[model samples]
Target: MEVGVWWTRFRAVLAFSDAVVVLGAAACVPLLGGARDPWPVLLAAAAAWWVALGVGGSRDQRYLGVGQEEYKRLVSVTVHLIGVVALVALLLRTDAPRPYLTTAAPVGAAALLLTRWGWRQWLHARRRHDPTWSHRVLLVGNGATVDHLSRQLASRAHLGYHVVCTWEVTSAHEVDIAETARALVRLARRNEADVIAVTTSDALSSELLRRLGWLLEGTGLQLVVVPGLLAVAGPRVHTRPIAGLHLLCIEEPTFTGATRVAKRVFDVAAAGAALVALSPALLAIALAVRTTSPGPVFYSQTRIGKHGRPFRMVKFRTMSTDADHRRAELLTANELDGPMFKMRDDPRVTPVGRWLRRYSLDELPQLFNVLLGRMSLVGPRPPLPDEVRRYAKDTRRRLLVTPGLTGLWQISGRSNLSWSDGVALDLQYVENWSFTTDLVILWKTARVVVAGTGAY
Candidate 1:
């Protein structure tokens, strides 16, 4: 039941799962009609991939159930393995069997990813039911920072950090570094905590942090120092060691150039393809909206986009024909805070509109907006002019990129998210934009839309 035991068992199961998947995929190459004498190349590639994953830090205890780093490393290892296989084939002048090189490798890689995801899901379930299965974390810092960090960790149980103890030292007076370090180690040992999460403060200076690390040198306890700067993504952060000092460097957020062009191209192509593929469903939704309500099939409202530009955002009409005119009467009944308006059971929403909104079928028309260069497949939610006007200076950063049909807001909680929380998620996405992030968001959007949580 201890955290270390659970982690060891989890990692062992994950390795076993990876090996089975790799061998299964390799075995299928021959069964699925591959080249003769394929066993040597196929088996070698499988063994290499399995070993790479085990040694590549993909299964590191720190990255098991949290963040995208594990998945990213998995992808990187797969790519490297494939490149090595191809180079070997070219140098030896022996054409690798197409099935072994292409089909088996890709299948094995996909299966490995799925296997890791499955193990994460299992680990999360176990942690949820038995918090002891999670990483026992001891929080160390000033009171305010510790409280803030504790609240964050408590809210995200799936991250597997369970706060077991807190050591709040006041910054008003200098503290004894050695004494504090010894006390921290004692507290961690007494509480059986696997991690010591420290928030930076004057009282817990760099010297104290260094001492704490030294005390925990061979204790097998992780020392996690949370920098004062919050909401910065990993991809935007880099570490530079200079003159015996480790410096944290934050890269400027990307907004234009090749990244923009790549994003734009992806948006247009995906939107165009989605429009064609879902034409029939779109027609059905359009017909339902038109027949069930006395309003037009599509509703276009002026929304604020990138750089504060106003554009007509279109969606399947999910309210009455006079929805805007009747909005004044329902202003006081709005369920959401801030400038946005939302109601769980608004009287103006038609029966069909309610259904459309639940599954987000109403937002399908925005694919056209995406194709028109006014919107993106993934970015901050497009705000209304009133909302934009109410935005504080920092909040205005959401306009740096084209608005999205679905973004962090859509997956996090949609209408269920508070105004401050919504702003924070948007800002995090804006500051940490990556193509991989977009893909992950898009993939999660499908599940959120199906579950219909946080939607009115």
Candidate 2:
């Protein structure tokens, strides 16, 4: 574990920068409206903006450089300041000067965001190898939750937290209220923590939580309780107190409506344009495949789809006509344990076929499936029928969405990933699918395919 000293220090910079930008924006009001004697009004408005930013928690160290908290503060301050400006303009009946007052909102918001991005870039560059870079927090749970938290942070260290130490006892489902409280108190005291992250699994009793909450009240240290919010991003974690009990109102997963329509529209539009753009190349590939081997140019096989439907997924053929019958000969050479088949240099591939598969040009024919709505332009790869057949009940949850031409697994390490790892990635993608995420994956896919990294 380490410290978020940089992140915390950056918060102060953001706060102070926010104040300056507010002052700068307010100053612009007079110049834009051509008001020579507007200094008094500008100063008052600037002062109010600074006060509003502080009140909106833009400078809170607790939210530094993590999740959407920083962004929320940025937005909240902007809206509040704009409200103040609007109220002033309305009171003064300044119709022609309205646009002048509006200038502060976007200008201040952009300034704050730009400042944060620049600071983050500097932080990431300077602290890549620094020992005390990220937040070093005491992880106060003994079981799977702690294990998961530690592994996740370790995997993506730049997200910036180190587990440092895990303090005390059994599984997440074991309940021992008083003893756990004692354990929690001792661990917090021993760690000299700047932050105490309580991973409250079912095992940690509410009494223990309350006890720890009470014991740490006056320590001037940060306390955080993390419920098992699953793959839902941090922005979704909202607490609503109903009848004095804090009820966390987690939003439901909805993959339908405008977003879905947009994705499909993008899919069809892109796929159609690609086919038109690559018409000659596609024809040449087809002719090359037919001449190089006796088999068909394109291949179609049954694959599992959304909601457990079976569909014939299409791809350019990359092996001999009877290669499926020759599988037994290569069975002993298989590198993977589970059902999916992959080898770096399989002898069954023809010269042209090998080149096609190497660059993933062979999978380009899946564009047809995407256009047909049988597959997505970006999503989890359509699992083979046999592959889905072997899936454990939980693993099949990914089939809840249409399989994709490219996905998280494709960009991560394709055929190189183990079966368990592949499913884990697919599930993560399904759970966290968003338009931006899809766009990022599509961009990364080009690089991965070009390099032929981990491709068979």
- Overall lDDT per candidate, in order of appearance: 0.88, 0.76
What are the per-residue Cα lDDT tens digits for candidate 1 across 289-369?
877768689999999999999999999998988989998899999887888888899999999888888999999999999
Residue 406 C-alpha lDDT in model 2: 91
- How many Å off is the CA of 225 in candidate 1? 0.8
Positional deviation of 163 in candidate 1, in angstroms?
1.3
Q: Give the clash count for each candidate.
A: 0, 3
TM-score of 2: 0.74
Question: Could you give candidate 2's per-residue lDDT for residues 251-319 as a string of tens digits?
Answer: 655578798899999999999998899889899999999998897889888999999899998888888
Runs with alpha carbons beyond 4 Å of true place in candidate 1: 35-48, 82-99, 172-174
Per-model TM-score on C-alpha atoms = 0.93, 0.74
lDDT of 1 at 364: 97
